[model samples]
Target: MSLLVEMRGIEKRFPGVHALRSVRFDLKPGEVHALMGENGAGKSTLMKILSGNYQRDGGEIFFEGKPVAPDSPRAATDLGIGIIHQELSLMNDLTAAQNVFIGREPRKSFGRLDEPALNRQTADIFSSMNLKLDPKAQVDTLTIAKQQMVEIAKALSYKSRVLIMDEPTAALNDAEIAELFVIIRKLRSEGVGIIYISHKMDEIKRIADRVTVMRDGEYVDTVDAESTPLSRIISMMVGREVSEKPLDVPDTRGNEVALEVRNLKRGREIRDVSFTVRRGEILGFAGLMGAGRTEVARAVFGADPRDDGEILVHGKPVSIHSPSDAVRSGIGYLSEDRKRFGLATGMNVRANIALASLDRFTSKAGVLDERGMRETANNYIDQLGIRTPSDTQEVRLLSGGNQQKVVVAKWLLRDCDILFFDEPTRGIDVGAKSEIYKLLEELAAQGRAIIVISSELPEVMRLSHRIAVMCEGRLTGILPGGAETTQEQIMELATQRESAMAPVGEVA
Candidate 1:
């Protein structure tokens, strides 16, 4: 195998920060190179420079042993380099074929869209990858796993010699990940170079041939994937050794019930699920990708209409018709997709921090208390350790972990008693994750009822005071927190297909 792409002494700078500093990276043909780093460690920055989204201040880029510069994404694509971002970028209203061939569509003699030809080409691509998807199907109608497949297919359609995948398995299930690996292996056999950026350690061990670690915007080390221990790789990525212990939270066994749900039902996804969370407790909801953990959170928070259910606050029934109702009842929900449903990206941090409790910053005459809001925002910025230059910084300018802290501060300012954290640490770094975990523990200690919905089994096992397993919208069972419960036990309950509504003895 030969070097397909190389970057030496790469440097990138912004207004007040050096985003990347003397970063060195290389990719070889037919080999999967893993880029491991914590959030904001310059993993995305380096890739963005390579993809022509950002221009490096100083660097040398070599492709196929020839020095080259790609001024735009089009130029990069023309050079047989394709990148699939962590976020899905497909237009929801467009058909699969349309999204796949968006800018490079086939044209007929009259310069009109060659609809049949486009669909046929897309079908061929899907067939080659053994992916079952209809070219004419609406992109919005597909599941997240299917949408990811479409992204991969789009990259492959460019006949890319070098492909970059960022967090490809972030939203995929085990089965979907297996399928993606098959495709990746096929590409490798065809001599395609692959650059994989992800925080998942197990995946790096399973699929990568070489591992490169980045820390604090600089290249740390690179080693053979098979020979490197996960701990050593983690140490290099964070610049320090990290303990693998689960987060610690106080026991909530004797606490009073804070929130309760009975016979909850939502469209096909959530069945007659029921659970109780006590004051000063972090109740974790664990399941597979489509296991209805998020759906249950949505229904409880009034983001979605429930078919039938009784929600109780402090043992008193409450009617929750919308998000406002839930908020008024002292409940707050943080969505899994932070960009879509959680924060206003264009807004400044101070404005977003006060978003949930704007009424508190209003006077009797309906005048906004700008000073008070600013003070509150400043307090949260200090307390949450949000890495922002100032409260006036745009939310999008902050890193993934900082943005998540902003969302948490939003709910904290609202004085919400019951909080639903959906994938709170999804794209966060190891350091930030520890901070968030500590924050959650402190919140629980303050007598708040928290429910965490996460797809990562280890996370659920670590921070939960009690674990509730959901499978296909049904609550399988609950287990006490601590060392007694294993990930496999939680998975068993997560995969349980029996209806929770059935009599205890009658269910599977």
Candidate 2:
């Protein structure tokens, strides 16, 4: 394999932070190089420089044995370099074909729009990739996995020689992931070099040819992915051996029930869902994609309407018609896509934390009590150990973990006792995940009832006192969470369906 791309001595700085420091990276023809790092480890910074999203403060880039400097994304695309960002960047209202050829659509004789030709071209691209998709379908109507495939099809349309994919399977199901792997392998066979960025060790082991580890803005080392132990790669990224300890189960069973759902049903996504969480317990919801874990959480939080169900807070039935109703009933929900549903990224930390509880911060004369809000925000910042320069720092500037803590602080400020965390550690690094886990334990110890919905089986097994497995919009089974619990057992239950729902309290 010949060298296709090389980046040496890359450095980037932003205000008070040195994001990347003399990092080096390289890729060969037909190679799938996995970039592994903690959240702030400069992987994205390096890639942004490669894709011309940001200019490198200092570096030398070589493509095909020659020096190259791409001043913009367009220039990089012209140079056969393409990138699929972690956040999917597709216009929701546009058709798939329109998004695929936004600025470079085929034209008619009079320079009018060539609708049929455009759709045909888009369909051809999809066919080449073996992806079944309608070119005329609206991007918003497609599933996240389908939208991701479209992103890939768009990149391939550029005939890119070097492609960078960041967290490509973040929202994909097992089947969709398999399909993507097939496409990636096909591209690899065609000698298209791929730079794959991800946090999932199993995925890297299965797909990557080589793994490059980065820590704290510096390149650590690169090794054959299949040969290197995952623990070694993890240690390289974090600078320490991460403990693989099982969660210590506390005696929270004797605590009073904080919340209960009876016969919860919503469309076909949530059917006859029933569960209970004690005041000082963490109940884990585990399932595959589209298994209705998120739907259950949303319905319980009143973000979505429930068809036939009853919710009780402290054993008393409560009617929740809206999110406001849930909040007033002492319930809080942290959505999976925090950027879209949880935080106001443009706002400062103090403002976002105080957003849900602004009613208490307003004086009787209708004036904002800025000092009080600041004091409260500072208290939560210290308590939660949120790493921010100051409370006035924009939420968008913080790392993934700190942004999550800010969301937690918002609900805490609102005095929510029955809390739901949906994919709380979705995109955070391992170090940040440990911190979030500790914080959840602390909250549970403080007698707050917590429900955690996670796709990772290990996370659910480690965090909850009891695990609830769902399959096809129904509660399949509940298992005890401890060292005795096995992934296979949970998976089995997750794939089971109930003929008649039983009371959760009576389940073993």
The whole-model lDDT of each prediction reads 0.88, 0.92
Minimal lDDT window, size 10, model 2: 499-508
Best by lDDT: 2
Q: Distance from true position, residue 24, model 2, in Å?
A: 1.0
Q: What tens-digit string does per-residue lDDT give for candidate 2 at 416-465?
A: 99999999998887878888999999999999999999999989998998
Which whole-number lDDT from 0 to 100 does residue 310 have in model 1?
Answer: 99
Model 1 spans > 4 angstroms off: 246-249, 364-367, 499-508
